[model samples]
Target: MAFDATRAGADATELDVLIVGAGLSGVDAAYRLQTECPDKCYAIVEARDAIGGTWDLFRYPGIRSDSDMSTLGFPFEPWDSDVSIADGDTIRQYIQNTAAKYGIDEQIRFGHRVTDANWNSEQACWFVTCQTAAGEQLFRCRFLHVCSGYYNYEAGYTPAFANRDAFGGEIIHPQHWPENLDVAGKRVVVIGSGATAITLIPSLVKDGAQVTMLQRSPTYVVNLPRRDAIAGKLRQVLPKRVAGSVTRWKNILLSMYFYQYARRKPDSTREKILHFARQQLGDAVDADVHFSPSYKPWDQRMCIAPNGDLFRALRKGRASIVTDHIEGFEAEGVRTRSGELLEADIIVTATGLNLQLFGGAELRLDGQPVDTGKRLIYKGMMLDGVPNMAFAFGYTNASWTLKCDLTAQYVCRLLQRMDKRGEAVCIPERHEGVEADDMVDLDSGYIQRAKGFLPQQGTKAPWRVHQNYVMDLAVTRFTKLDDGTMRFQAAPSRSASPTQTATQAA
Candidate 1:
């Protein structure tokens, strides 16, 4: 049931679990809570008016899933289409369908933006504050689950280029694409060589725009067919769910193998990727200058152009790639450091994302504030020293849903164990002398920029994020609940002196 704290007062409705965000992760969390912990009453508090998260938010030209839908889609729900990499609109519809099919939509409280979550040790409950359309509201819950994603939704990362304001043409960011921006028969210049730029160039070209991709440096790009034949064949003989499971595992293993191969045999893998790009472009362009990246393959994310669309556009003279630094924005277009002038009717800054954690919500334990930057992450889901909280952050090396599904299952298990043990408070204890490392081991601009804000990883098990989905599957699904690092305690009696911490061995 929905509660209006503004009209009904602060402590209006109490919930067993309170989930933040209505995206894929949030929906998955809600489904798990409803199924695994059926007795618990939970509500999803979405800041946005709609669901689908990144899929719904990104509406730029040719926006699609970088990962295959077999692994990216939910395990319970099979993607019926032959297209492995789906477009944004199709993915959005899939999410919406999933919510409706499971009746998860009814539990969502839209337009509720979580501003702060404070844990009361004495009461063993969290008082969650949100900024709603009506007014400020409060929610009380036994557990708090954050699935708000890792990037800022309001804006994309845009660098302040010199003389940007002097540009005569309209400058746009892919994050905030105008609904009716005309691009037909126009000269378009896209800034950045990442996934978004690659996806945009082909799309803009198809739309009758003569597009040019201007990049500071090259990123690894590979071409794969739009449809997966193996998945298609399996679907003919097997049930939808079975085929989906088979395809998902096959993709997961293959992705992991390729990532490992790239790490172990960087030079060969890089050569193979560049060779493939050359095959697609033929003699139209120099793959060495435009496709060869300075860094090794998988140093950052490798860009995949479905059905070689980007290469086809370049080969057909619909689009071109320029590897040069931008000196500044000229009145007509962009001026390069090499003194080359490129005129454009529109400039697109497909730069990157601005990473954010927990929707930038302030967290407090008891009466003291919690600084996530200083704390270590426990099992890649829970922050150390934070009680009754879990965040669904997915794997960087594979499809995001693969890791998030495991995380949801683990959280449900935890709740059930706590209930069985009659525990009201559970927290991960940080031991002294434990070495801390960077949260993510990526050299990408976004990850590097947000390092100070992300939670640190530890050197040992449970504290470190393996990033490998197979390894995490074992750790998250089968691991002991009462590990040595985690401490669980029952609620204190009214006449009791104070709260006490109890530690147990794994």
Candidate 2:
């Protein structure tokens, strides 16, 4: 395959596929593309200086995947460790190792940040604009695959606390934890009831800091073991790959069953969760006062307490949780709405993440700016009315990798189908009367706040998004590429003359 300049930008590098980001989804996409579509030429442009998108970015004291690693990790590679809840460093290494093993690392172009992707129907390719270390670089690809994780990597969401500057202590957000930040023998107050805040508390306590977690409201929390005994047992008996697949499916099924059960029977599920939560707390904190949540179970993500480490911290008097609203910041600490001052030598605002799509890159159709929020997602991968482009958005209620894995496979399937049919473009055209709804239906703060930026879903199949892995697996894997909704087009002009085609793309 050679570069095609006639149908693409004069200086643009032509590729069969262009992947944005070298994160989990990007790595997974590369694996699928190379294995399934061996003839296609592809490249991964990562904005960051290194691999492991989220894992490399967040370096908080106790950063770890909230979900079990069996599902969080790539489906092709088996997680070697017994630790279901893996630390950030280990996970980063795992992703890097996986990429290197599969030769996906060779496809990565670090420091190339894709800022814009414009579609040209005549060329049947996307002209992608990227900001690199030297300057701007352009790429033209028939298919654009966005594997960037959903979040603004530049910064995390931090609320404006009144008189925050008046505080005499060093303030930090989990997104940018400074090096040599010693919290030993100091009072530390971590604001927010989300997973980040919950994770940092136990770690801060271990660092010899007197930790106090301040939250405006209580969030549902549950404890899962750090290691999966069943996974370990399966590994010992079955072949490694077989064991990994089994462990992955076991966790996926359990997660699906639990979420559905909780949604269907919120009252009973709530009671059961609270009962187990209370047992973990065991009088270390008052359940009604500090642990009881206002929302039903599964409405928002439940805070995972790995091995009940957080509970142990509270019981041992190393850490405490305070449910209160921040009125203002004092010279020495945070002032509550009730006028109780929470004295702290250090404050960590683990508020939440700022949700972003497509790595903050702008999309255009025929030079007209496109709003994904107004469009519907197709098969939880491609966007409705968007041709030859796919973005990976993982399962909200389950492991992020589960949906991404299927999405990559779906893209490969679509590509193979397109090649076989001699189609240049494929777009899911929504029919009339397809009512719009939020793509991600979670009531979490991050999702709710970013509703205006996120895409919408329809009330029907192929357009309606399912958070369940089992449902998505069935639909994305087995569903025909040329479903009635998808409109496939071929450029007759390109087929005839001095123009761009898959063979011309390198």
State, as a TM-score between 0 and 1, how close model 1 is to the true structure: 0.95
Give per-residue CA lDDT, model 1, range 34-64, as digits (tens).
9988877889998889989898888999999
Model 2, span 1-506: residue lDDT tens: 33344645668887889999898899999999999999888999999989999999989898999899999999889887679999999999999999999999999999999898888776778989899879999998889999999999998999899999999989998899998888889999999998998899999888899999999998888889999999999988999899888998899889988999999999998888788778877877887778788888888888899998888888777888889899999999999998899999998999999999999998998778898889998878888889999998988788888889898999999888888877888899989989998888779989999998798988988888989887888898887777889998875565421123444653
Which stretches of model 2 miss by more than 4 angstroms?
1-8, 495-506
Task: Give stretches of model 1 more than 4 Å off.
Answer: 1-12, 494-506
lDDT of 1 at 398: 81
Q: State in Å the error of residue 312, model 2.
A: 0.9
> Which stretch of 10 consecutive residues in model 1 shows the poorest summed lDDT?
495-504
TM-score of predicted structure 2:
0.96
TM for every model, in the order presented, reads 0.95, 0.96
Name every residue pair that clashes in candidate 1.
Answer: none
Error of 1 at 100 (Å): 0.2
